[model samples]
Target chain A: MPRFILTFTLLVVLSAGGCSPSNEQDKLTVVVAASAQFAFRDIAEEFSKNNNVAVDIITGSSGKLTTQILYGAPYDILVSANMHYVEVLENSEKTHGEPFVYGCGVPIVWTMNAEFDLDSIASYFCLPDVERIAIADPKNAPYGEVAVKYLKSLGIYEKVKGKLVFGESISQVNEYVLNKTVDVGITAKSIVASPKLKGKGFYRELGEDFYIDQGMALINTKTTHDLKTKFKAFVQSEEGVNILESYGYKLSK
Target chain B: MIDLSPIWLSLKLALLTSCLLLIIGLPIAYALSQWKSRLKVVVESFVSLPIILPPTVIGFYLLIMFSPENAFGKMLGDAGIQIPFTFTGILLASFIYSFPFMVQPIQKGIESVPDHYKNISYTLGKSKFETFMRIILPNIKRSVITGFVLTFAHTMGEFGVILMIGGNIPGETKVASLAIYSDIEALNYSAAHTYSIILLGISVVIIIALNMLNAKKRR
Candidate 1:
C-alpha cells in the first residue's frame, strides 16, 4: 500500500508539472466556434508559422465557449460563430475590447450518400427514406439557428420535424454527415468546404442571404498578450481571409 | 417557466430501463450466483465494466457500431430499424450503461440465499423455476429494490451517453439532464435552475426513501 501510494503521488506530480512560465507566456490559446474549426486550424497554422509562436486552438459551440470564458477559461481569444456570444462575453465585462465581426457563415445541407438528391433540401428532407436528419442545437449554435430558420422559411419544419436530430454543435452535425449516422445534416458550408472533407460528400448551399456574422474578441481584459493581438490581426489579414474564403466563409467587407 | 417535457421523458426512460433491467438481470444474476468456474470472473468483470468506464466510451462505440455506413447498421437499416439519434438508441445505450447497477446487487442477494433453502424447495418437489420465484426471490427482496432504485437513479443521472447519441430531440431523446445542459449553454439560467432543483429534489427523495426502507428491513 505504501509503495502504491508513492507511485500514485509521483504520477500525479509528473502529470501536473507542465506549467513553465516562459512557455505559458509564449503560447496563445484561442477558443473557436465549432463551425470555424477547419478554417481556424489552417489560420492558426499560418499565424504560428508567420509569427514563430505556438498557437493552441480549442473548438466548441460559441455559447459553450462563452460560458467557459465567463467562468474564467484561460483562452486568450474567442472566435465565435456569431456576435451573440461575443456580446454576452462583453456584457459580462470579460472582453479586452469591443467585439468585431470577422466573417459570415452560410448554412448548407450535406450528405455522404452519393445517391441522395441535394438540389432541393426541403423536398429531399420530406422523403420517407430520409429517416434521420442532423442539425446543431439552435438553443446554442448560430448555424443551428440558421438551419432551423431555413427549414421554417421553406414551410417544411413541421412536415419534416420528426426526422430532425440535434447535435450540440455544427461540428457534430458534420460528424453525422461524414460518418453517415444521419441521412443528411444541416451544417456550416465551411465544414464541407474544408480540404479534409472537401469532395468526400455532397453539399448544397442555402443561399447567401441567410448568413451568420461571426465575432472575435480577446478575453484577457487585464493585460492583452502580444501573441493574442497578433493572432487577431492575422485572422483579418489577407492571407487569413484567403484561407477562410477557401473554406467557404464570406468576408463582409 | 420551464418545459416539463424533458423531465417527463427522463422519468419515462428511467421507468422503462428499470423494468427492463429487472426482467433481464434476474436470470443472469441467478446463473452467475450458482456458477463456480474461472470464466465466471471474466463474465462478472464484463458486466461491471460500465461502472468503471466513462460513459463516452459506450457512446463512441454505439455511434460507430450503429452508423449506417457499418455493416451491422446497414443490415439493421435494410430492415428499417433505426438506432442512432432516437429514443430507442438512447434506451439501448442506457441499458448497457446501467447494467451493473441492476445486476451486481441482485447477484449478491442470490448468493446470500443459503443452499438449504433451495435444497428444501427441491425436496418438496418444487421445480427450479418455482423455487427461484418463491423461495429465492422472497429472500432477496431488499437486493431487488436496491438494484431497481439504483438503476432508476443512475438512468436519471445519465448525460454523457445520451448527449453523444440523443440528438436533443424534444419529447423523444431530450431528457432533463440534457435540457439543463442546453439551458446553461444558452444562458437560460432560470430554466436550468428549475430543472436542476427538481432533479436534485427527486434524487434526494429517492435516496432517503431507499435508506428508510433498508433501515426498516434491518429492524
Candidate 2:
C-alpha cells in the first residue's frame, strides 16, 4: 500500500512538471503594434484554429515596442506602424534582418458631434469656437506625425497649436473624439472605420502624401524557435494583405 | 530646468482631491467604524474597489460615464458643466483613484478610538453629531493627516486615469505624470528623467515629513 502511494505521488509530480502550459507556449509569443491588434488577433485565431500552437500577442506603439525589444522584451514578431522603428531595431542589431513593408497607413480627421461638417472641417481650424483638437504624440506615433504634416499642409499648424491635445496612441485619439473630450481629432482611417465611432463622428480621408508605409520585422537574435520566420511568411502572404485591406489599410506589393 | 505648469497642475489636483476626499471620506469612515453589519462589510469592499482595480479600467468607465453623449455627461453638458479633458475631470479621477487611501486609514483611526470618550460626551448632554465632531474627530486627527498625505502623494503620481480621461491637454489636464509619459513616449529620456527625479524627490520629502510628524506625535 505504501509502494502504491509513493508511485502515485511520483506520477502526479511528473505529470505536473511535464504539463506546465506556460513554458510549452513560450515559443508562440508575438508582439505587434497596437494599430495592428485587431488584424493580428484575427490572423492569430485563424492560425491557432488549425495548429496546436498558442500565440501571445502584446500590442503597443511601434516606438515603445522597439524600446521594449531593445530592453530585452521577449518578443518574436514586431509589426510596426512605420519602418523607422523597425529600422531603428535593425540598425541597433536587435532584429534578425531587414524589415518589410506590409501595409500603408492613412490619416483621417474625425469629429464626434454632427454639428461639424466633414467638407468644411478643415476651415474649423480657423474658428474661435473650436477649443480643442486631439492628435497622438508625433514624436512616437506615426499617425501623429502624419496628422501634423496634414495640418502643416493646410497652413493651420500654428493656428491649432494651443488647442492640440495629444493622446498616447491612435486609439486614444479616437477615444478622445468619441468621448467628445476634444472638439475634433486626427486618427487612423481604420479607427474611423470602426463601428464604435461610425455615427459618433465624421471623418475625412487625408491625401496619400500624408500616408505612412508601415513595416514589420522579425527579431531573430532573441527568438529560439522559427516563430519569426513563420510569422514573417504569414504576414507577407496574400491572406495577411486581405486582412489589412479589410481594415482600410493599403497593402504594399 | 523643468516646465513648471504640469507640476503646478499636479499639485493643485492633489490638494483639491485630498481636501474633497477628506470631507467626503471622514463621515463615511466615522459611520463605518460604528457599524457592524453585513452591509457595512459590502460598503467597505466597495470603498476599496479603486485600489484593487486597474487604473485603466477605472479610466475607461469614467470616460464612458462622463462622455458628453452619456446620460450623466449629457446632463452636465446641458448644465454647462463639462467634465472630460478638463481640470474638473482630473480632480474627479484623482478623487476616485485615491478614495480608499483616504477612507481606510481614517476608518482604522476611528475604530481605535475608545468608546468611553463617546459615552462620556453623550452623558454630558452632547448630541451624537457634537460628540463625533468634538470627541471622535479630534482623537483621529493623526489618521486624517495620514490619509491626506497618502491621497495627495497618490494623486501626484496618477497617470493611467488622467491620461485616459483628461487627454493630456496642456495647462488644462496635463499633469506631471502625463508629462513624464509624454517625454518617455517622445524618447526624450533626459526630460523624462528630470521630471521623474523631481517628482520622486517631492514624494520622498512629503513621505519623510509625514513619518517625522507621526513619530513626533507618538512621542
Candidate 3:
C-alpha cells in the first residue's frame, strides 16, 4: 500500500509537470478577503493536512481582490465580504459555478478603552467631547457601507460628518481604535474578536438589518476542476461553518 | 477627465507644508550647524527620525498623539481644534514626514558657507543674526530653493501618513495619492490611471522647473 501510494504521488507530480509550464507545482491557491484572514488561515491549515494540495492564501480588501481578479490575477478561489463581487464575476464568466453564501458579517461599534453605551451614543454624536469616529471606507469596504447606512438611518450622518475617520480596511479601522485615534470605531465583529482587540476593546452588534452577506466563488478559468470542487465542498461543510461561527460570523442557513 | 480637486489640494498642501517646514526646519537646521553640544547629536537625530522610520510608524504615533483622548489632543479639543481626520492633521503629518527633505539640504548649504565670510561680517560690525540673514542665507539661496521644491514634491507623494490621519475626505484631506489609491481599490482603474498620469506629469514638471532654477542659479 505504501509503495502504491508513492507511485501514485509520483505519477500525479509527473502529470502536473507535463500539464502546464507555469502551474507545474499543482498547488491550490485561494484568494480571500483580508478581513477573513484569521478564519481562512485556520481552515486552510486543516484542509491541507488531509489533501494532496498546498493552499496559498492571499488576503486583501474584497473590492481590491475583485479588481485584481478582473485584471487576471491567478487564483483558484475568491472569498469576499459581499456577494456583489461574486455576482459581478459570475456575470463576467469568471467563476466556474454559482457563488455560495458561506457566512454573514455583523457590524459592531467597538471601543478600545471603554464599553460603548448605545443609548448615549446618539447624544454623543452632538457632544463636543467625541472628536473622532473611525469607520472603514464605504466605497470599497462592506462594513463601512453598513456603518454609513446605520448612521444615516439614525439621522446623524451630517452632524458627525466632520469628526469621521475612514480606514482603508476593517483591520485598519481596528488599528485606528486600538491606537486611540478615534473615540469609537465601527468595524466587523471578526476584528473585535481577534486576539489583538480581545481584552483591549468591546463591541456591540449592529443587528441583522446592517449585516453583510459574505460569499465565495471558484475562479473557473484558472482553477482545476477537482481542486475547485474540493474547496467549494470544504467551505460548505460543517467544519467550515463551525470555523466561521468561531470567528463571530453567522453561518448562512 | 479633469477632476481638479486633488490637483488643487495637492498643490495647496505642498505649498502650505513646505512653507511651514521652512519656518520650523531652517532655524533648527541652522542651530544644528552652529552649535557643538552633545545634545545637538540627539536633537539632530530626532529631526531626521521621520526620514529613517517608516511613514506608517510615524502616522500611527501621530494618530495616537493627536487623537482627542491624548493629552495634546485634549488641550486642542478644549480649544475646538481637532487634529486627526482634518486638513490640519494632514498638514502636520506631511510636515513631519517631509522634515528631512527641507532640513538636510539647507543644513548642507549652511555648513558649506566659509567661516571667513562670517568673520568678515563680524569684523564689519554685523551681528550674528544679521550676518546669517545677509551673507550665509544668500550664498545658500539655491539650496533653500532645492529644499523647498524637494519638500513640496515629497509632500505631494505622501500616502500612508496622510491616509492614517487625513480621513480621506474629498476637497478637504484627500490628496492625489490617496485619491489614486481609492480609485484603484474601488476598481475605477480609468480614474486611477488618469490621476496617476496627472500626478506623474506634475511631479516631472516640478522636478524640471527645480532643475532649471538650479541651472540658472549656477550660471
Candidate 4:
C-alpha cells in the first residue's frame, strides 16, 4: 500500500511540473513594504509596459514580509521600508547579496481635517477634539517605529500614549486618519504625494533627523532568472531613481 | 513565533467571561423571565439583540463609546479608569459579547417553568429569594450549565470583537485567535497551526460536553 501511494505521489508531482505553462515564466513577483507601495506600483506598471513580463507587487509590513521570506516564501525581490530587514536577510544568506538603498523614507503627521492648524504640530495632541492618534504597528512596520521615535523625540509619547490607535500598516493608518476615525495619523510622505491623497489633509514632514532609507534586494542566487535580473537592473538605473524622486522619495540627501 | 501566552490569555479571558456572565446573566435572565410589564418585550429585544447583531457592529460602537473623547469613556476616565487596550477592556467587551449566550438559555429555562412551583413555595412562608433558590434553581440546573459552557466556548473563539476593542496588545489583550492571525501574517505557519488545533480541540470538547448534558436531561 505504501509503495502504491508513493508511486501515485511521484506521478502527480511529475505531471504537475510538466504541465506548468509559459505564463508562470513570464511573471516576476516583487514584495514591497507598505510605505513604498504607491511608487513601486508606478515603477512596476512602467516596467511591465516596456518589458513583456507581468510584474506582480506584494505589499505589507516589511518586518512581516521579511519573516515570510525567511520562512521560504517565493519572491524575486524585496523592497523594505527599513533597510534593517534587508540587512538581516542578507546576513542570513536569504538574499543574493547586500541590499542597495533606493530612497529615504520620510515620516509625516497628516490630518484630513481641513479646520485643523498645523502650526503648533507638536502641541496638536492637546487640541480639544484630537481624540485618536493613529500610527502603524511599531513592532512590524518601519514607519510605526519612526512614529514612536518621533513622538518620543517630541517628548509627548507618554502623554499621548492613551490616545494612540495602532494600524497594522501605514496604508491602514492613512485610512484611519482620512476617514476621521483618528484625528491625526503618522504616515509616509510617499502616501501623501500620491495624487488621490494630495491636498486632502494637512501634513508636516519629520525632518532629516528621523529619516530612514528603503532597501531593495534580489531574493536569492536562485532568483537569477533573466526577467527578475532585468527588473533589478531597471530599478537601479538612473531613470528608476528619477521615478522614485517624482513620487516624493528622496534618493539621497 | 510560538508562545503559550496566547493559550493562557485565552483561558483566562474565557474563564473570567464565563464566571462573570453567570453572575451578571442570572439577574437579567430572572428579571426578563419574571417581568409582567408590557415593555418587557422591549427589554427582551435589547437583550437578544447581541445574539443577532454582528460582532463588528457591537465592536464598532464599543470602540466609539470607549474612546476618550466620548461621553461614556470620559465618565470612566474621570474615575481614573481606562477601558480600551487593557485587560479590563477585554473583560468588558467579552461580558457584552457573551451576555446573550449566557442569558438566553437560562431565560428560556426560567420562562418555561410553571408558576405553581413558585406559588407553592411562597405559600409555605418562603420568601421570593428563598423560593427561587429552593425551587426554581434546581429545576433549571441543566440550562444554567449549558449557558456557562456555551458562553465559555463562544468567548474562546471570539475574534472580531476582540480585534476592535482589544487592539492585539500582547499579554494584555492578544488572545489565542489574534495570536494565530499575527502568526500567519508573519508567516509563522507552525505556530498558527498549533494555536488553531488547540482552539479546535477545546471547542469540540466543550460543545460535546454540552450536548451530552442536554441529551442526559432529555433521557
Shift in Å, residue A134, candidate 1: 0.5
lDDT for each residue of candidate 3 in A69-89, tens digit (9 for 90 to 100) = 654445688888889889888
Clashing pairs in 3: none
The per-prediction tally of clashing pairs is 0, 0, 0, 0
Task: Write one digit per residue (lDDT tens) for candidate 1, span B71-145.
Answer: 998888789777876678888999999999999999999999999999999999999999998999889988988
All candidates: TM-score of chain A: 0.92, 0.85, 0.86, 0.88
Instruction: Put down candidate 3 lDDT per residue, B67-143, tens digits, no spaces.
Output: 65567878887898867766788888999899999998999899999999999999999999999889998888888
Worst 10 residues of 2 chain A by lDDT: A15-24
User: What lDDT score goes with residue A216 in model 3?
Assistant: 91
Taken in order, the candidates have interface RMSDs of 19.8, 22.9, 25.1, 19.3
Backbone clash pairs for candidate 2 read none
Candidate 2, B103-165: lDDT as tens digits: 999999999998999999999999999998888888887888889889989999999998667
Reported per model, the fraction of native interface contacts reproduced equals 0.00, 0.00, 0.00, 0.00
- For model 3 chain B, where is the 10-residue window of minimal lDDT? B181-190
> Best TM-score goes to which candidate?
1
Of all native A–B interface contacts, model 3 reproduces a fraction of: 0.00
Q: Report the lDDT tens digits of candidate 2 across residue range A1-253.
A: 2353355446535533442333445245566665666677677876666565677665557776676565444467788888899999898787777888888887788887677777776688768889999998888888888888888988889988999998877756765777688999888776554443345567788878888888888785445546666766776678866767877788755
Which DockQ-derived CAPRI band holds candidate 2?
incorrect
Off by over 4 Å in 3: A1-23, B1-219
